[model samples]
Target: MTAITGALAMAVAMGLGRFFYTPVLPAMMTGLGLGPAEAGWIASANYVGYLLGAVLAAYGWAEGIERKVAISGLVATALLLLAMGVSSNVLVLAIIRFLAGLASAFVMVFTSAIVLSHGLAASKPWVQSSHFGGVGAGITISAAMFGLIILADSGWRTAWIMAAVLAFAGLAVVMRYLPRDIVRTGPARKEPPLAWTPSLAALTIAYGIFGFGYIVTATFLVAIVRVGGGSSLFEAGVWLATGIAAAPSVAYWMPAVRRVGHANVFALGCLVEAIGVAASVLVPLPAGPVIGGILLGGTFIMVTAFGLQLGRQLANESPRRALALMTAAFGTGQILGPVVAGYLADWSGSYTWASLAAAAGLLASGAIVLIYCRPRAA
Candidate 1:
């Protein structure tokens, strides 16, 4: 029950809050007459909010205000999603997305922290990694829901309404299962700020590279497929495949990491994802996106889970601060990815160069991790 509940929270906050935007992007472009640049800017707005929320969480604001903000974020996000159904103004949409991004980050960081403390007390640390599958599950459910809406001939507005309904359902589960009393792992250890460690600085920069590498395809894959003349069902199926592949990635990769070491496995996942990201544009038709989605979905969460674990290992005194630093690095890259890709695509009349550039970034990051982040000899 605890694991299920944690997964549901992530499904709502990260999956629905963050990713539902991917499938819905094409609809909005068609319905709202939004250009690629406009859509990219809106997406970047969300990342900005995410960075702010994560910084607040890291600074210990979450320790006292988390419960209030958690509930408020869930409720507010639901209403904001519903509001999206009624508003077509670009400014309004951007504001709502930004706030929703902020709320989602709060739910993700604080709830995970809360759950981790409980899991630690219960001696069930594995639950921390396992619950991340919720992001994939949420992605699957949202993709299916959007697919059904399109099948019913509904527009972008109805899709937003469906997403809101799904968020509300998840909210009920969260309110019921999330621990009301905050659980403390132990006395907080004092450590220097995250910027002090050379190794951590490298890790932080690598994480940002990953964020840049993946965001382009993650944001625009559906649109790329649509422009390539794929059917709506095909596009949804690609996204669904990504979620399904993602759902079990951590389970599979964790064992590998245990054997080979975190740095090696992490770097390998980056290479795999780079190939997948490039495939979206390099290959053809349903085959391209489908293959790309599988690779993209399967490895991203593994990289994230491993990266955070590595951060905690490095900055044992204050894992939360490490997380904040990582989020800031990652969010900054994400902020840049879409906007740059959008402009590049607009200029080139193709996503080819942009996709290749993202892949190159991932490869470079993998190299950095291999050289700088490798685990020391026992």
Candidate 2:
């Protein structure tokens, strides 16, 4: 019961915070009078905030700070979104989005580290992964609301406001239920009296690539499909839901992480991601979108889960630095992904090149995982 409670709290914190962005963007543009460039910049600004917030929560405040970080982050994110309701300037909106993004990142880093190190202990991969399944659940909620709610003529801003209301309500729930005594561990033991080995470096670099590749699809997949004989926003919504359905790989990979190790799980997930991306271009149909989204989402979360698992393993149970590196690498990729996709979309007026780039990045991540990370017994 305690574990389930913890997972749900963390899930709401991470899932609700991160999953509602894209759906709300269209409305924001239409009603809020945001230009395309502005919308994109705001999205990217959020990513930047995430990068900074991740850095702070992952390392600088690893001890006695988890609950404070989580609580404060959730509250701040709610406020930032709520504030956008009255803010007039694009500059103010961007700043608020960035801060919201950062708050989400802080909660994510803290909650994820807790789940990985404490909630699931060192033996329960399935538990941790299932917790990640909350992301998909949260996305489903956002998608459903975005689709059903005919908010005011105000467009995306209204949706953002609604999302803010929902998230704030969630924040209240988390505050009421979240545990307080998160035992902060000391400096992690070293695998061989060294923390920054070449393998770790390789893993970090590969994950950076993973971030870049995954975002290309995640940020633009719906648009890409719409371009290539795609269907309505309804169809895109279905595809997104399918992608969410695939988010439980964290649980699926848990046993493998215990039996095989983090490296193999990470490598395997990346390899699958590469396959999914390639398949996306080749089979850009309804079934194709469904398959690709499921595969891609599953693998992506596995990489995320295993990254933490491996960092914990390599750091001799201390994951502060490795986790920080992983978050930064992935966040950097996410920040660049949309820009690269947009550039490609502009240059070719099609999604072929962007999807190709995504495939290439996934392949690169897989290769790195194979070379540097392999599954080991937990």
Candidate 3:
């Protein structure tokens, strides 16, 4: 029951609250006369909210009232989506998105803590990773909604309205099933000396780079494909492809990570993601977006899971603090990506430079992780 609810909560928090924007972007642009720069600004606003939310989570404020806050966040997110449909003001949209980001962060942090801690105590660590499948499920469902809107020739406002409805449905399920009491598996081992080893520092930086590295593509891929000669069907198809690839990624990769070790798998995932990012620019027509979507979807969530798990191992003494720092770094990187990419696209009249730059960041991130986190010679 906990696992089921955990995945559903994630779908609502991340897939709907965060990523539904990807499929909705082109529609909003066409309907609202929003340019790449304005769209980027709106995206950045959400990310900034995410950063703020991460900070709050890190500080452990609202610990006792987590359930109330998490439920409120989900409700707020649904209302915000409905609000987006009612307004065309860019500033208003930005504010709504920012608030939605806060809601999403609360749900993610609180629900994961409740779900994973309970699962761990029950000797079901695998259920913890399966919880992320909710993200992919949410994305796929959102894409399907967007596809239907396109087929009906409905405008962006209608899309937002429908999405809000879906969010409410999800919220209802979550409210009914999410565990009220989370059982942590006691304390996490004796406190290890809090030391900043080179590897730890490198992993932290690499994690940030990964955040910046992926956000550009993740935010703009549908838009880019639309401009690059894709039909509405093709545009929706790519996003659905992304969700499909993402859904099973953690399960598929966890065993491999266990065998090869977290550092190697983390490095490899980054490198693969870099290739995917570059492919979006280098390949022509639909091939680039299609193949790129698969690769990006396949790795991003896995890399996140891997990085956070690795952080827990490193900060054995204070896993929450370590995870918080990593989340902060990631949120900071994400806040910058869309703003820069959006303006760069506006100035250059293309996304080529932005995609290339993001790919390079990913490559550099991979190198740092490989070199610094590599196992020392025996």
The 10 consecutive residues of candidate 3 with the worst lDDT sum are: 185-194
Task: Give the clash total for candidate 1.
Answer: 0
Off by over 4 Å in 2: 9-11, 27-39, 83-90, 120-125, 150-154, 184-194, 228-236, 375-378
- The local lDDT score (0 to 100) that residue 236 gets in candidate 1 is 85
Instruction: Estimate every model's Cα lDDT from 0 to 1.
Output: 0.84, 0.66, 0.84
TM-scores, all models, native as reference: 0.96, 0.85, 0.95
Candidate 1 lDDT, 1-378, residue by residue in tens: 777877888888888888889999988998899888899999888888887787777776456566677777788778888988999899989898899888988887777777776778889867876688888888899998988988998988999898999999999988988777457646544335655477778888999999899889989989889888998888888898988998778888878887988888889999999999989999998788888899999998888878887877777777888987788888888889999999998899878888899999999888888888785410
Runs in model 1 deviating more than 4 A are 185-195, 376-378
- What TM-score does prediction 2 earn? 0.85
Clashes of each: 0, 12, 0
Tens digits of per-residue lDDT, candidate 3, 1-378, equal 888888888888898889989988998898889999999999989988887887777765565666787888899989988998888999999999999888888888778777887888888878867888888888889898889988998888898899899999999998999888556446323333446767678888998998899999999999989889899888899999999998888888888787888778888898888888888878997899988889999988888877888877776666666776777788888888999899999999988888888998888877887888767310
Which pairs of residues collide in candidate 1? none
What are the RMSDs of all candidates, in order? 1.7, 3.6, 2.4
lDDT, residue 49, model 3: 88
Cα distance off (Å), candidate 1, residue 341: 0.6
